[model samples]
Target: MTWARIMAPLSGGQGDPPTIAAAVALAEPFGAELACVYTPADVADVMPWMGEGFLGGVQTTALESLKEATAVGEGNARKAAAASGYAKTHFIGLQTPVWAGLSAESRLSDVVVFTSDPARGRGPLAEAFQQMVADEQRPVLVARPGLKVGGVVAVAWDGGKEASRAARLATPILERASRVVILAAPKASSRSFDPNRLKAYYAARGVSADVEVLSDSGDAAPGLLKAAGAAGADILVAGAFGHPRLQEFIFGGTTRTLLGTDGPSLFLSH
Candidate 1:
């Protein structure tokens, strides 16, 4: 498996620079296209709540404000992309049906890129990040500062469907990794599985990997992070376990812990 395109949704906020830099780093290794999409607030979402009795002038003013914000956001996003100096970058500004356009872009791309702020629900792209990971079920790269793609990669496995899917989708990245390590905590998980099986799976794809069995612990995230840091890993590949809760998605305990830490960039799939 090879990546041909990488999508990064920018909210025209402070996170755009790091997000674009991470996207460019990933794309450079595979000579992939970096699709930087501008996502602005949609005016249509607020129209229904304005009620039928709202004044015409108030509605017009609101619409105008949204339009102005969109224009400014697009300009900021474009500037960020250009500053990356990546030749294969493309900047796209979504129209009225913004969510639909974002969905289409993510569907066609090999993977979506997001910064930690958004993943932690502390940035403008938080909602879009949740939509991509939980709702659209797209492969995502939760990038951190100084992100690198073709470095030591760690995979967290527990013999679950989500873990299997994440490892499979991350094959291209693993293939390019200088070293691959499979971190397993059989005692931490309820499922019984062999880490060697995953190592062998990677061998079939011409990728060599080492297996490290973590000591028994109630929580696995801490162990996984410690091991990955010890190995000087650039990215950790894992399943994003979460479910929708009201307007937000609540991640599993382990996943939430990993997301909260600033250790390594995460390559996750639902």
Candidate 2:
């Protein structure tokens, strides 16, 4: 099915612009609706965190910060949407937890887009994004800010449920891709399923795709990066894997590696 709606979260940061642009570009051809949602920090939680007899001062500061953040986020969203040629735009002020609001909104949309933070090394926001991927049951695209994307595209396929889901969600872009590469990581056991199924699928959609199986003993992110570079791909598409909590505890291994690495921008789904 063609994408009809796209949901983007505004988290009081300037890093979401590229993601917003990508989402709009992907949605425009399909005449999809674009909605931007911002999550304000919880005031109630701030009061408890304040020191003894400092509740009033903390409350005032927190409210001011929240207001500023909301204004900046909303303004950025509007500007980005307009620049990206989105026919319609929405600004939603979230009263609940960021993840909860995003999850709820994602249910109503075909795709969700999120930005990755490199300095904090994948903080709560990344976790929330991953959780949305695992829980939303919809496609989620995570884009790193400041990355220029176009041209060749690579799809990391392991024949898992997540891979299949990602491939389906990325069909719109894949259809327009100049070159599509399906990189299959080596597996120990012999399997009947062929990764060529995806190559054939893209070919049917009028995309020129080449399939290859790579034997690498290194990590998945690095291996994928190498393959993408060799294929001259400017965009990488893959299913986000690994348990969120485990990745967090390890300071964000797979996701962080992909986001921080020097390569083409990645489109992630779970």
lDDT per residue for candidate 2 within 245-268, as digits (tens), equals 653423235556776776776777
Show pairs that collide, candidate 2: none
Angstrom error at residue 15, model 2: 2.4
Model 1 segments more than 4 A misplaced: 53-55
Choose the strongest candidate by lDDT.
Answer: 1
**In candidate 1, how many Å is residue 33 off?**
0.8
Scored by CA lDDT, what does every candidate get?
Answer: 0.91, 0.67
Total backbone clashes of candidate 2, pairs 3 or more residues apart or in separate chains: 0
Clashes of each: 0, 0
**What TM-score would every model get versus the actual structure?**
0.97, 0.77
Please give the lDDT score for candidate 2: 0.67
Off by over 4 Å in 2: 44-85, 118-127, 144-150, 187-193, 201-208, 246-254
Model 1 over residues 1-270: C-alpha lDDT tens digits?
Answer: 789999999988788999999999999999999999999988778778788854587877887787888899889999998999999999999987888999999999999999899889887788999999998999999998768877899999998998999999999999989999999999899989998999999999999999999996788999999999999999999999989889688999999999999888999998
Mind sharing the TM-score for model 1?
Answer: 0.97
Question: For model 2, what is the error of residue 7's alpha carbon versus the real structure, in angstroms, after optimal superposition?
Answer: 2.1
